[model samples]
Target: MPDRAPQPVDRQLPTDEARDLISLVRDIAQHEIAQKAAEEEDAGRFPREVFTLMSRSGLLGLPYDSEYGGGDQPYEVYLQVLEELAAARLTVGLGLSVHTLAAYGLAAYGTKEQQTEHLPAMLGGGLLGAYALSEPASGSDAASLRTKAVRDGDDWVITGTKAWITHGGIADFYTVMARTGAEGPRGITAFLVPGDAEGLSAAAPEKKMGLKGSPTAQIHLDGVRVSDDRRLGEEGQGFAIALSALDSGRLGIAACAVGLAQAALDEAVAYATDRQQFGRPIADFQGLRFMLADMATQIEAGRALYLAAARLRDAGRPFARQAAMAKLFCTDTAMKVTTDAVQVLGGYGYTADFPAERYMREAKVLQIVEGTNQIQRMVIARHVAGPETR
Candidate 1:
């Protein structure tokens, strides 16, 4: 028999409204996103229309204040919605996460006037955003970025190349970190640069191992100019703003990782129950069953870890350490679970005819994005046992 469709996750939502919201998200995932995920991803096609639909449906700004076109959902509810989207398609889920990351500086630190003027359009008006912090010379050491933003009267002229920007070529706006003062982290400033500014451009997308449907490219700002009003937060405070945004962004990545691992586990289970050997389904074998069991356990643990971190965030408490721990563990779980899923299906898992191979490939990137697992470890270590002395 053909593999059975995966069952819906039995989520422990806080309210009837939250449950209803999950139901709506699941319906969209099943009907609108999941149906063409494989085909579109294989073809490297970005699903702009799906994002448009999500914006219209109020899914784009779930964790922000409703006064500014946001859904006003807490991080816990929002992360669950992200999990559903990611289980259907990682491209969509991670894309939404990147959009939220890009909007964070403005939403969290912008002046009231800035929020009143721009938040509505960005939150729900069908605009896509990109976060630009990584440069050609700096990835994990984002504090060392050399992108220059020179003040000229009331405008800032930004010039440099940002590497590995999600939605680089296609974003409507970008939250860019550029050096505006001396050297090092304290010199940085964040700007809200329009994607189509005079000298802003993106190079061809990178040929990545996974998430091909989501464009990751080098964004070049050659004297790109933005008015002083477009600056996010105070000048020389960009690094702090970026770090604060990343704490929440790591949770988003963790939720997406759990979702990806869940999908892999579901695929593995379906294959095990249907594929036969020795006159019985492979699921009857103790070894394969054990693998499945382990995969499931890891996924559940990862889900719990990310949700606990999300709850901490929703409560307005310090969660950077928990967020780092969640990112590290969940992404590691995704890589392990997806690889074991590939092993479960044997030869068939290695082919494009099934999704197991794609899941494995996609799982690898989760370990590296937002911040590498190595970076996460450092973050956790700092929180637990004081900063390392140089």
Candidate 2:
């Protein structure tokens, strides 16, 4: 007799609002998003239609206020929605989350006047966004970026290259961090650059191993002129705003990793029960059953970590360390779980016939991007031991 299929981890609802949001997200995931995920991923095609549907449904701005045309939902609710989307399609989920992060500088740190000017379009369904921070010379050491934004009377002329931009050419707006003063992080400042700005162009989308449907490319800004009114925050505040945005963004990635792991685990459990080997279902074997147990356990822990961090943030507490820990653990677990999922499928798992292979590929990227697991560890360790100790 085959072992029972693994059950979903118990979800602790943070609020009634979160529960309702999950139901809606799950419905959309099953009925709409899941339909084209496999085909689009295989063809390396972007899911523009899916994004349109998401935008129309108001999911694209869940964490923003309704006055700004947003859903006014809590981060907890927003993250669950992200999890459901990621379970169906990682590329779309990640792109949406990163877009939200790009909008954070304007939402959180932008002056009232700036927010009044930009938040409407940013939260509206039609606009898309990207963050311009990383560069060819600067990835982890973001302050080392060479992009320059020089002030000349009423306007600032930005001339530099932004690498690993998520939306790239597709975004309607970009939050760019460029040097305005000296050489260090404090000299950096953030600006909102419209996609159609003159002298701004995107390179060809990178050929990544996974998340290919979500275009990632370098953006070149050459003598692009914009009014000083476009600046997001005071001079030297760019690094602070970018780091704060990343703290929340890491939680989004953690949620995404959990969703991916859950999907892989579900596929593995379904396959193990149905697959026959040596006159018995593979799930009947204790060895395979234990592996499923481990996968499920790690997924539960991962979700709990992110949930804890989300709660901390909602309660107005310091959650940077918690978010880092969650991001590190969840992404690493995703890598391991998806690999085991392929092992569970045996030969069929290794092929495109099943999603486990693609899932494994997608999981690896999560561990690398949005601050590598190594960077996450450094963050956690620095917090654990004070700055002076480090």
Q: What does candidate 1 score on TM?
A: 0.98
CA-lDDT, candidates in order: 0.93, 0.87
Among all candidates shown, the one with the greatest lDDT: 1
Off by over 4 Å in 2: 1-10, 388-390
Q: lDDT, candidate 2, residue 269?
A: 89
Model 2, range 305-359, lDDT digits (tens) per residue? 8988988898889999999999999999999999999999998889887889999
In angstroms, give how far residue 70 of model 2 lies from its true place.
2.0
Residue 213 displacement (Å), model 1: 0.4
Q: What is the RMSD, in Å, between candidate 2 and the native fold over all Cα?
A: 3.0
- lDDT over C-alpha atoms for residue 116 of model 1: 96
